[model samples]
Target chain A: MSDSSSILGSTAAPDREAHLTPAANKLYGLMAEFESPAQIVAAAEKVRDAGYRWWDCHTPFPVHGLDQAMGIRATILPVLVFFGGLTGTIAALVLQIFTNAMSFDLWAIVWVRGYDYFISGKPMNSLPAFIPVTFELTVLLASLTVFFGLLLLNGLPRLYHPVFKSQRFARASDDRFFLVIEAKDPQFSRTKTEAMLQALKPLSIEALDS
Target chain B: MSTLVIDNTWDDPAKRAPLVLNHDRFDTVTAEICRVNEEAKPPMAWYVTFGISLALLGLLGVMVMYLLATGVGVWGNQHPVMWGFPIVNFVFWVGIGHAGTLISAILFLFRQKWRTAINRFAEAMTIFAVMCAGIFPAIHVGRIWVIWWVFPIPNQMDMWPQFRSPLIWDVFAVSTYFTVSTLFWYVGLIPDLATLRDRATSKVKAIAYGLFALGWRGSNRHWHRYERAYLLLAALATPLVLSVHSVVSFDFAVSQLPGWHTTIFPPYFVAGAIFSGFAMVVTLAVPARSLWGLKNFITLRHLENMNKIILLTGTIVGYAYAMEFFIAWYSGAIYEQFAFVNRAFGQYAWAYWIMISCNVITPQLFWFKKARTSIWIMFIASLLVNVGMWFERFVIVITTLSQDFLPSSWGYFTPTWVDWLTFLGTFGLFGTFFMLFIRYLPVIAIAEVKGVMPQADPHYGEEGHEHESEHAFGFQPRRPEDKEEDQS
Candidate 1:
């Protein structure tokens, strides 16, 4: 069984590579490489005008309005961050209140007294006094929540990506921009997508088979 | 073969890039950059920085050595005034440290593009300021060796730190602040180190950068995780900065002292911290850009923007001052009223006027666009802001301590040589760190700066847009071309 699975996986790798070769379809979607953010954005606008929904823009840095230009909105992470923050707040409040008010008080001396002396004209259980501790707990919990929560929320820790397959993708960190229209987009027909992407006039365009 | 199938549609983590900077960029900078990297060593601006910072540092070192040799009896704290210059300097330095984190973390979280130019240095200033601040408290305790008593340690005596004490909270708050800020600063350095790593030619430089870079290879997955984590840290730090200073303020306000016990101390201290912090940034940045020839990167628009913050925070601080006075008068408390009056006209009245001149009068010039943009004027204003902030602390600590409930105990306090030396020495310590930071670290975030340039962005093409493009990633649009270049 193991040998069969290994054989299947090895065979699939070549099949995947062969499927991604651009020679299979010269009319594949154009992948424009841009040096400037402006070109990517302008091309994105032109593609939008050309009614090409399948095309995408890429850059080393996130181009402003590029998302809106490409008509992208709202990732799944923010809602996740919100829930994480909320949980953090709740957890902080509970833990602090329990620890301070209940858990570990050595009240042997105070227990005999029916009531405790209230100073500064306030009762023993003043909410305001609890504020500092509550706030500290809130911050502590919220911070941990955001950090780890973001990690978990984003489903991270895996260490590979398809963009890494493109050697030029490294320039995204320095001074380069990119835009590609995937074959998967509903509007992506090979010929029309190529025509639409060509009209935008990027620095260079290549067909990316994935 | 009865093979079991696994789900591939669960959002494959393999789709995301592992890191941000790849091997190519790193290799180029490492091998070719120092010689060809025109921006590496712009010109001879360090002479001026070294001269001033070195002199100040020398003064500080001499002062601290004197204090350590002598005792804690030096600067002004007496029987009723257990905490004077040391406490005042602690608060002042801590306040000056606020702007750095506030600018780097809070503004970064808000997606302010203008922050890119100065945030690196600003964050460094924060660390240095905190260092200077941590000193006063440590030394003020006299037997510095036993300062560990402030920590909640399970020792042979079996005594725990008083949980309810504000001073205990401050110990946690300050330590937490320093740790977080250091982490934040180093985390931001990782990418820049990769840039340097790629540029380095010498084996030692390569090793240094490599070690700092921690095997970073600009994989997309790395960027995704890094970006998210950075944002998360920024979010955490913003609240921590606020909370730390608020706890610091609580140290005085929680105590039932005549002028010290006020509800307004937190916001007041926070405002002053931001004000002094901005002033310190301006002071350093104005000189730095001119000295380092970073006119294009650290532009005049950056100065103007910082000035705007200085003006805003300064006003808030001024208002807090006025409010304190008003509250004192409104409450009909003689001691409170007397505290304000005495602050303006007592033995430390000179300090009060200096504070007024620096805090209130100087920043007002920034209301004018011309004044805000002028490097010289901004520098002077920044200097004044520091002086004023110091005096403000002096006024607070001294005035309150000089006169308490009993008129019989009300005696004038003066700083001995020890107090002065330690104060000076701490300044030296801060200057040394800052000087070293500027010399070594990429004082500006190279990648972040490149990100903000006009040509780097995808929207602007070659024709009319002369040079560069900047990217506005998450929130507020960040563009370098939008910045007004520094003429100086």
Candidate 2:
């Protein structure tokens, strides 16, 4: 069950032949395993060459430099976070402006039956009073931006995925390493795909039959 | 021709008890260590925490009911001291929150592997602390029901919250902080939840855990995305943590009040937040390690590292205190000069001394390695730090306001019984959440700690040898058994 030997010892490099068994895809795909970080990276590169735009690399821990090596771009979550924070700021400003400057203007001007009360003779729309709200909005928006943005960016709440169907995939969370190329990738073909993956020196190659 | 002694850290294989490979071995080890006996189902520590937390929670509940039934006027918030226990509690909880972020984000950036054991708990504390913090400000508002007025909306009442108000800014700062902290906690929990889901016995636990796990099959694809997101969150959170506290400090600094107005408030507050936060972590963690029998997991090395930070930040905060006094003297502004003078030798001189002893003197003991590593000593020091920090807030709030610009307006502030009860309640609330976290969630982050093992950490390839030494010291790894068949 350890299967460490098969994963660690792949000698038939770039074996170009394909044995066709349509039913073998699910089990076969999982049989092909990765033992080291280097092998996973190599498989990822080949996955990219095979034109699979959407795929991932899984490991027990964060694999250093995997994102760049896998050619994943910077996330849009930051920009989303920025916008959320911007909204918080604007909301804070408008609320204060309406309440203190516009809404309360008449009372301020009237000044309790013309008995003059002055806070350093400052105007009704005092910008100084707005500091707290401005500070709060900036924080509010930015925090929300990060929170909701992460969820949307990750497409979370997904209760199922094709990878979950493979029992071997579970170890990817604990000890194993994996490189999964989605079937939706443009250049995905049975024979050429397996050949390309074999060249990348995985333990073995298996099609995701399902 | 090279004759050099290359002493490996892990010298021998099979030195310690084998790693607990099967679920049964792991569970038995935990049950024994955690003191789960059928006759005596709950441990003494459990009773203490539960009883204390429940009593505190009851006090909080009753106090909150009174506040709701009457008004915020129940507590002593009179002239000159407009912000009282509510603001103090708010600041204290926020400060408590700072340690978690310091542990999770800053240490994460530095790749300090030692943090793995406590980061999960630390982050949980952050979320809970923030939760407690959020409650204070909500009730601080006189019309608690209309708290939504702080939000920006074109309501039927034709009103908007003041944009430039420091209070409004706090609302945003705290809410944002809460959101980000929650997400950070949840994101970190996903993999652990998946682990639990796979290991679940009952159908309900499996389904519940599975749902939360988000169908995470640990595909390379999912991990690739998850890691990217985690790194991004840590990056975002680091600055956010600093800014959030800076904004909190701005609540006081932007004011022209004698003690409150200062340019250095932002950095000063942030440093103090971290200082107070690390102190709280030690206060909580020392007891937790002993009670949970996790001495090996939360090692002396970890305690030493935290103590070093405590000392460094305590010094920085002390420096801030000195600089503030010096600047006040140099400015020659009568108001500022009087403020500093009154704080040192005025009506609240006792509070000032407490702050000095707790914040300044206590952390100095950490200068010695022996003191830092000694749990009892560190615990006492941590308690002093908290006491000092609370007094620091009290000094800042009370001393400056007690004597304002006008001689006629000078009046001393006093905390009534209500203030004491409410303050005590918050402690109850904090303890309640922490106890709950310990009971349910994996307190030690099994996966993360396992990752730090000799087999896991490639840099420390000889960890296997240290097992025997670890056992002699009264700790042993779980016995190994194959559960691979069940897993596959």
For all the candidates, what are their Cα RMSDs to the real structure? 12.9, 10.4
Report how far off residue B329 is in candidate 2 (Å).
Answer: 1.8
Clashes of each: 47, 31
Write candidate 2's Cα lDDT for B110-144 as tens digits: 76766776788888888888988888888888788
- DockQ of candidate 2 relative to the true structure: 0.15
Per-residue alpha-carbon lDDT of candidate 1 for residues B45-90, written as tens digits (9 for 90 to 100): 5555566667777877676666677776666678878888889889
Model 1 Cα displacement at B340 (Å)?
1.4
Worst 10-residue stretch by lDDT in candidate 2 chain B?
B468-477
Which candidate achieves the best lDDT against the true structure? Answer: 2
TM-score of each: 0.72, 0.77
